[model samples]
Target: MSGGVDSAVAAARAVEAGHEVVGVHLALSRMPGTLRTGSRGCCTVEDSMDAQRAANIMGIPYYVWDFSERFKLDVVDDFIAEYAAGRTPNPCMRCNEKIKFAALLEKAMALGFDAVCTGHYASILTDVDGNKQLHRAAAWAKDQSYVLGVLTADQINHSMFPLGATPTKAEVRKEAAERGFSVANKPDSYDICFIPDGDTKGWLGERVAPVTGDILDREGNTLGQHDGAVAFTVGQRKGLSIGTPAADGKPRFVLEVRPISNTVVVGPKEALAIKEIAGNKYTWAGLAPEHPEVEFACHVQIRAHADPVPAVAQVVSTTAVTGIDGTVELRIIPAEPLNGVAPGQTAVVYVGTRVLGQCTIDRTVSAVPVSTPEMIASASPVPVNA
Candidate 1:
């Protein structure tokens, strides 16, 4: 249980179903805050206490598992690395992939548990062949399948989501209240759980060490400068502080961040449109799609709450790598251009309500191209260190 209304109600339902339920609250941090900052943080000491109280009411076994070290390595450190590489990553996606499903599920199975149930707003359905497939929850507004896209076939087999069929979050809250759960009215946590204050830039600044970098346009002309390339992300416009406006007198959006060159590239908003994205790291949710080499129709969602867009995808083999036969990548071509997509972002593929698979974007083909190659070659990087 997460010490939240949804999880408490989920535990209640699991118990009512006549199965032995054990509530395990993960101690993701060694030093957790005793009080919640009004839903700004989670996995705190307060959350663990709340979870234990709910478990007491349910008359089930409950324990706080110390997964702090693993969480730090898999989720927190990976987040910093991705940012330092100038790529925006979803820590929630990493948490679900590495911690909740991979690590926690491993421990549960070893302890003779049949499944690891949670309050995630997603569903697991068994097909005719008894293969488990991940699907979207009934509550569209609260759907969390995008984050759970990292689940593989094996993980989905041993996962349960009691809140999947609920029509709304209000229903979960009502059920919690009816069950006398103290967390019924508790505010839901938001933003990065580890960074409770929601100042991601400041938190990353301390680790990445911001350095003054040149901000350039597509034509390789210096437009402005920024304190740190890590602080900026693709499509950001508000804080560029580029004193010189575009020649067209239009606002520019961040097109790319080059950590190696310590450069931030800004361009017209249209330059943000991407026609295609491809990633070498890809996994199927249950079964691999048919005709791996041919294009298949699907919908691609880049963010948790973003609407899925109609697209076509295919698996292709790239240059050979050592040991491996050849590097393979999943490429998606959206019917309409995707705006502001960046490397390290997860793309969840869906066929109707069923999640087909996902990929970590490694590269993107821009819908708009630079005017000339000469300009790009001519633009020299201004190194902050030098």
Candidate 2:
């Protein structure tokens, strides 16, 4: 349990179901203090106490597992690396994929556990043929299946989500309060646990060296200046300190971030319209579509909260990429042109509400060719949206 109302209530429900349950709280940091300062904070001592109190009420054993080392290497470092490579990554997905499911699940099995259960808002269904599939929770607003879309079929088989069937957060809170759990009224964590202020740009600035350079328009005209390519992302609309306004007065958006040349490229929103996205490191949840490896229709969600759109996904072979035989690619035709389809972001595929599979988007093809942005030869940077 994360010592949150949802998790505490989940534990209570598991006990009510007559299963032998033990509560575990992950100590994800080597230095955890109640005042660690973030969304959920770090030094889980106080959180552990809250968990212990809930475990006491549930009358189940509780323990704290230290996975700080593994979490840093797998999730934190990987996040920094992706940004340095000019890609935006979903750290929560990495935490789910590497820490929660892969590493933690392996440990659970060794300790003789049948499945790893959590408070994630998603449902798992088993077919008559024993095929397990992941689906969105009934509560659409709180659905988190998009992040869990990275799980493979094997991972799905070993997971459980007790809150999936729960109708609403209000109901969960009510139950927690009725059960006399103190965490029933705890404020929800809204920032990244490691980032107390949720200032991603400020945090990134400390680690990524600044290389002041040009911010340019589609026509190669210098619009403004930028501190470093890593500080910006695709689709960002503000902070380009370009004094000159466009002749047409249309707003500009970030078309791309190039770490190599330390360049920021801005253009009209249409330049960001992408028709096809090819991804590497694909994972499948269950059986492939009828054609097996050929392109097939499915609904694709590019970012969390983005509506699922019509698309086609296929397994494609590449002679250039050694070792791996092939990679999965999604040819997405969004209902409207897709903007901000960033590399390193996840593209989850679904059929109906069931999660079929997902891929880490690596490249995209615009609906039409976007002009190569012109470069500015000087520097006078400003904050984004400033």
Candidate 3:
């Protein structure tokens, strides 16, 4: 339990189902604040205490398990590494992938638990063939199926989301109030819990060695300079330090960040419009499809809370430097233009509300009119999804 209203209600429901439930609050960080300052944090001492109080109210056993070492190695280190590589990554998704599900679930199984339960707003469905499947929550507004898309088949099989079918978060809060839990009114955490100040750039700047680099335009012209390539992300418009407006008097956006070359590529906003995305490091919630090479119709979501857009996607083969020899590659062609899709960001595939699979975005085919020879050569040929 995360010491939130949703988890409290989920634990209540689980205990009410006549099964013996033990509450385990994961201590993610070794050093945590005594109290959360804002609505965007978790894993503090106050949060752990709240979970313990809820466990007492439910009359169940409670324990705090310290997974700080593993969390630092997987989630925290991965976040720094990805940024150093000049790619944007979702740390929450990494936490879910490496810690919450992989580490916690495996430990729970070894401790003799049937399934690891959570309060995620996503559902579990039984397919027609008796296989279990993951689906969006009934509460559409609160559905978090996008983040949980990284779960493997085995993890999905052993996981349970007690709050998945709930109508809304308000209902969960009301239930928590009725149960006399103190955290019913506690706000949700949004910022990176470890970075309580919410200054990600500042936090990273201290840890990563700074390297000065030149910011370049499409024709390899120096526009400005940046302190470090790790500070900028693709599609970012601010902090370019590029003096004077463009000849067309248009605002420039960050088209790319090449860490190796120590160059930040700047261009017009239209340059960020991408028609296709190629991805490696794929993860599926279930088994692979019968035909890996077939192009299939689906909705593609680039980030959480963004509506799933109509798109065609498929797994394909590639010999590009970004792809692996034996690893299957994902190719997505959105029916509409997509902007700000970045390398290292996840592209989750869906059919209606059911999640199909996901891939870590490796490259994109920009719809921009002009490109340098380097840009043309860097991207491999994109296979049409449909």
The candidate scoring highest on lDDT is 1
Model 2: lowest-lDDT 10 consecutive positions? 377-386
> Whole-model lDDT for model 2 versus the true structure?
0.77
Clashes of each: 0, 6, 3
Model 3 / residue 52 / CA error / Å? 0.6
TM-score quality measure for candidate 3: 0.95
lDDT score, candidate 1, position 386: 6
TM-score of each: 0.94, 0.89, 0.95
For residues 141-207, write the lDDT of model 1, one tens digit per residue: 9999999998998999899999999999988888888888899889989999999899999999888
Give the winner by TM-score: 3
lDDT of 2 by residue, 71-145 (tens): 889988898888887788888889899988988899989999888888889999987898989999999888889
Candidate order by TM-score, decreasing, is 3, 1, 2
How many clashing pairs in candidate 2?
6
Q: lDDT per prediction? A: 0.86, 0.77, 0.85
Best-first order by lDDT: 1, 3, 2
Q: Positional deviation of 299 in candidate 2, in angstroms?
A: 1.1
